[model samples]
Target: MSLAEHVSQRAEKKESSMTQQTQDTTTADLAAGFAAGLDPREVAEAVLSRIAEREPVLNAFYLHDPDQVRADAAASAARWAAGTQRSKYDGVPVTVKENIPRAGHPVPSGTALANPPIAQSNAPVTDRLLEAGMVILGSTTMPDWGMLSSGVSSLHGISRNAWNPALTTGGSSAGAGAAAAAGYGPLHVGTDIGGSIRLPGTWAGLATLKPSAGLVPLHAPYLGRAAGPLSRTVAGAADLMSVIARPDARDYSTRPYPQMDWTKILSSPRGLRVGLQLHAGPGAAVDPEVAAAVQSAAEMFSAAGATVVSVAPFLTQEVLTGIDAFWRTRSWADYKALDEEARGSLLPYIARWCTGGKDYDGAATIQNYQRFGQLQQATREATEGFDLVLSPVAPMAAFGAEDPMPSNDPDTPMTHISFTLPYNMSGQPAATINCGFTSDGRTIGLQVAGRVGADDDVLAACAWYESVRGDAAPDWSRVP
Candidate 1:
């Protein structure tokens, strides 16, 4: 055969592999459905129907246009029919968080502080997803400046738990979490600086990953900030990760990394060194139920022949307080830039929290900066000897939908993030998988964190845990 024929044959075989599957909206599923001649318009309509059913109570989106969704699906269907589908994910619907820009869409930044401008271009990750032929559903909602760890947003209104509408879906990826749990579609892209993605992953009973800082490209990369995937299953999250992590020249920070074989992201936990952390050094005490769930999951590893050891709390109040101080300074700068009316539109809770930036002198600000470094060093030291650490994703289950955070105190908003924050600064890859549930049916998350740049292993460990967790995983497809 000619070279061109060989390449075409390869593509055909690859496409054929995705032909037999279900209609769950997972990338694999959608790809299979498409290969079987399933109309992309039908998939779009089903997802829209789901959104209509869930949106009124969940408030899980900032921009959800059925017209736009239909348009994108039509384009994907055309590509598939022409045998020029962008990638294996063609026709799969996915939602982008409001803060992550898609060309021509306004990034609201999760606050009512001002009318955010329409982005003139796409964030690198967004471009990659579009290139892969994933249909964009719309932008999801988040809390003010993504500062709070709950669903109450000043601009987008409050997003609620998918499991129970009265409860909050953890923020700033609030809408993504709710959408995933409600099965609005297969993929939900979110960004996390502290615990935004995983907190919501836990609260909403989803699988999510916070890749190493530079592993997934971001437009304006900053310390600890990363773009990642949130989905109902690890396989779904992995499908999105493989695409978003593709090299992009715009984000120079995403460089010099070996190509990953995502198929290898499922391994046995046997013979692996594991550390168990029930208490985050200083923050909200893990509720008894939450702690028990984590502990039980850890014991499963022990039973599976993995060495499990308890690690001492490594965080300090000084570091937590200082990091908050630095963030206060950053947000305050943004607040000061706004005109009087725009500033007045800011969320009062966040305003009360970060306004103290004015009080910090140069020396104090430097001191706060030092605290962030201390946190980075301390987190590294705490998880140094272990291959992976198992911990509770949150102190408790979802809180009231209207509360700004789990603590309900702006002064101490970082309280629930202790378990998941350290990995962000250390640039370690961490994942959240449902290990158990609260007494009332809310899900509890088991955090699997690997060393810095160990994204694949972190995912593998999460997959291993999920396999062993058995029926504990929620039937999101069938769940209400």
Candidate 2:
């Protein structure tokens, strides 16, 4: 398929059943409810109530205006009553990641910057969601400079896991994960440059699709960054995609594609070639429990008639380190742009991580940037013959909520991302589904990645898995 082409597409249970969970109202349900005369105010009230009850526990949103949410929802309810709702899913409450610009909202990027610049306009995805009438509950928080895979944010504090407050929410997309698990709303939009979306999605036991890079226009599009949806259901994420995955002149990265039926993409995986990747190659060894959970998930796919082949790691330690160098250099430049106060107030770990690159010459930056293409080539070569690939989302289990990363070593903080970083570089569509839970009660995410630009195909296969996975919706509350 071409970059602008359209294609069609088509989990297991976890231990320690999460009981006493808040009810999740999917975007589809919210739309149906509105169509059937349900008031948007009801959704606003319920969501606000949930946030009011859990925000202190999770620290999900960096800027949530309940009054504005209620008022917009009331306006949506008025539209529904007048038979003029903006779109099918109008009035569905959703949250934007702190990094994604929302008009009048600060784009902190999870830094403790004393005064971050306010965005003058909405990002492409945010604009699309607003045009479709989705109510913006607020911006979800993330770790400093959006550089960590854990939720120890310097600005909004820690975004605790809903499954266990002591555990990390595995981020860059941290608060979105917490809010989704806490049932704040059905739809959320987050960015994924290196597992930011899928890691958090998996840790929070949510369904997330990191679509082909450039498929969704970003306000500040980068090499591997893609704005994606994190929702309680694959359908909900797809629904959000239907709106956000549109052309935007602001994003030179965007390709021209016709609007997709989104629903038609959820097809079966009965005759697909699936590569089963056990290890992420260069990072921490895959946790035994996580591997087992993924193994079982692969078996489920095999039973569904996919040709599940075992695949070897394509990433090397050199490439991993090189990529980390690129990130550090990039972050260091940003770090240098800020005032001394902002720089000093950054999370200590992040500050140190960026400082490591302060002396990097242009040669070092170019060499590190070249590793992106090297890894991309390796990933493309590894999965060339497969229609999709299944793997663990991260190498290790959930770590402490306050730790900057699972390794907790600023000098070497990217091992867990080895599994997820590849897809971002390759520009492939990868989704994370709840396969099972770890012994410590953390959720295990089974990653499903399809050919680049074949988002519909992979999502369809995921939809198929969701249908047969026999598990109830992920246990969102504590397992008592």
Candidate 3:
């Protein structure tokens, strides 16, 4: 039978009582439900129903197949009912980014110009998640080529923040953030090159971890390496990371790290040195409320017996210039290859910058890479004594949906990098936690970054902060 027909058959067999029970349970609660003999298929059906009802307005999902999800869920249910649930993520529904390949799923990577056929095999990370028993609901939206920071995309359209759909949800993992924040799914897999994962988490009031470069594999169909989770809590993010963190033969860049037991290690946050820095460069423009929220989080850490110190050596213009040059130079080939129609379809700012191709020369590219290396070294030196660094996740909360990012300033401009990209360049592990809310009711995030191999420390710090300041649960009532 066709995929749609398969889904219809399963939907027909779904019991009303089972639907009610699954609909009422949280993602964590659903895991508990499976533990209690509840059917995984029922849970998956309820999740698909929730997404069907909510996605039309949210625009979070780019591709979905209810039949495939039902089949996977039924298999998971059988495993759970037989006392053989394979992994920690058993029965959980997750949204995968378009850039990550899932066998038989169309992964256009958000480019309207190119419609690559459905993938023939799963990306290594996707395989890991499936092996761990998670059900894939659909692909989430992201920027064309994953180049821009704003969540607007020509291929899948804009993914607005869940708190207020009128505002931007941040990108390139835009739709993943919206889905998690809107409760379309409890877990979302996203990529980060610039502020992709953390920025969206900040705007949508979700938790996210941009694992240290190489912690998660990035393979075919994904040009750059990035795979992380967007979720309602830090522990949930950690759990997803643990499942996808193993080294894969497909990705030569995958780092060798001990497999983490998240439940055991992240049970409580203790013995961590936290450093707070609001300014990263000479002209870092930090929104007053955002800075205040970050400071308040630091104070909470102090009260929780963690050392909080103000550190300088913030992100400098030189550092940003170098990073920008690196991206332009590295992605130059890809931009040039795009046909005019595809080029025309991109967000204007992205099209302008990406297509420019004249800013940095070969020598400049190498120099920028060298300069970035120095900055990474400097960051490591400055943060040597600390276990984690705390700061605002973004310069401000979600901007208006119509005007996603400022477009005028280009050279050494003081824009939204106050909280994000530095960590990306540094290749350090970073996470965003819901620190508080703006007066306008939009969410604000506090960023915690750890050293190269300190992914667990970052997760633990977020967990500590969450314990003191409770998690900001998504407002389902506002979900469209």
Candidate 4:
């Protein structure tokens, strides 16, 4: 046969397979329905309808194009009808973090310094989602350069928590967490260097994964940055993992090991060793309700036949502060590079963060990294005998949406997120699952972290917890 004929035949075969498949817009349900011959357009319409109702109040999306959604859905529908569906998540509505590029959308990195320019191509994770047949919903919001732990961004404005409009959505994955909690759809993407994913997951009452560095590839790689899914269900997040964790040539940090079936690992975590560590170190105070929720989840693990024990904090306050110092030093350099006008336009909190490391030299920066390594080594050694460590996802609950951090006190912000950042420095997988809520009804999260390359195990424990705990959340729009 001619080369052209062979190519054409392959294309026809692909189209033939497109001829195939949810409540709360779960990607799994949508994909299953599409495979069973359901029209993708209906799913698209439902998602769009939900967005129309929720966007004004939630501010979860920075860029949502209904026309694009419709067009993609139509194509997916045709493919399914033709039995040419690409992957399991095909036609499922998925949102990406704005910092991660999407074709034709501007990624301003949630900063005034970002001069908007349409991207020529998608980020690696974005490409993976598209390849699997997932419909692109829109890009979600973040804090400026993902600086703050709260959702207050100077560029896109505040992204309010879905549970309570008056409360802040923990960030810099603010929009992803809020959207997941709000039932915007079943799958959303979030990035974490510090506690961006888990903090929002904790505050918004959703499940988020900060997969071990390189477990999920990025378009541009960095030391402490990793990205993963934010979902209402652990299974939904696992589904996203199966797609987005595909290896990318751009990231060399990804493990050389074969990919594991995350969905299969969601079995009960019986016989696993779990540790409860309330704080990263002393002097970091955790709210009573938050501590109680984490303790409650540990008890649940014990009930499931796992050996649960309390371990002294492996990280010191200096080590905890070192992680933030590492970030600030980089930000300080970036601040120095910015022209006068751009510097003037930066958000006040971010400006403060940038200047926080101004007095430190490169030698000080290197010392911070050295301290970071020591902490990572110590943490791994301490948890070596355990399968997972259980802790409060945040030291505090969601506060007012307008506040820069938990309070006006500059020192308190890091304390609010102390438990989650050490793992980031360690380059280990960590996740936050809703364990309970505070007295005022704000959500609390129980964090689960595993050794590097144990992303599957960490997620499995969370999924198991979700099964017993039940993935119940208040519908934000329905409230009041």
lDDT of each: 0.83, 0.83, 0.74, 0.79
- Name every residue pair that clashes in candidate 1: none
Worst 10 residues of 2 by lDDT: 2-11
> Tens digits of per-residue lDDT for model 2 on 1-480?
110111010012111111111244566666766776666776677678778878888898999999999999999999988989999878888999988998887897887777788999989988998899989999999898789988888887889988889989889999998888788888888899899999997788889999998899999989999999898788878888888888899999998655556787544567889999998778898889989988988998898788999999999999999989888988888888877877789988988998888777999889989999999999999999999899999877778898888887888888888889999999999998888887667788889998877887777777777777765247653521
Measured on C-alpha atoms, candidate 4 has an lDDT of: 0.79
lDDT of 1 by residue, 1-480 (tens): 211222234335433222211224466766666776666765677788778877999998998889989999999889888988887788888898998898888887887865588898999888988888888889999988889888887788889898888888998899999988887888999999899999999998889999987899898888889999999888888888998987778887786677766666555778989999998888888899889989999998999889999998898888888888899998888888888888778788988888878778889999998886787898899899999999999888888888888776777778888888888888888999998888888889989998877777788778778887886788664555
lDDT of each residue in 59-149, candidate 3, tens digit only: 8888888998988888888887677888746878888888889888788777776676789888888988889899988888987777766
Candidate 3 deviant stretches above 4 angstroms: 1-27, 220-224, 265-271, 282-284, 404-414, 470-480
lDDT string for model 4 (1-480, tens) is 211222234334432122110324456556656665666776677667767777899899888899999999999888877878898667888899999998777888888665776788888999998998889889999988888887888887899988788999888998887788777668999999878899988898888899887888897788778999998778888888888887788787777756676866555667888888986684458988888888888988898888998988877777767767877888888888988898887888788777887867888888887877887788778788889999998888898998878765554447666677778778888998889888888888888999888888788888888878853343444532
Global lDDT of model 2? 0.83
Candidate 3, run of 10 with poorest lDDT: 1-10
Better of 1 and 3 by TM-score: 1
TM-score, cand. 2: 0.93
User: How accurate locally is residue 351 in candidate 2, as Cα lDDT from 0 to 100?
Assistant: 88
Assess candidate 1 and give its TM-score to the true structure. 0.93
State each candidate's clash count. Answer: 0, 11, 3, 20
Better of 2 and 4 by TM-score: 2
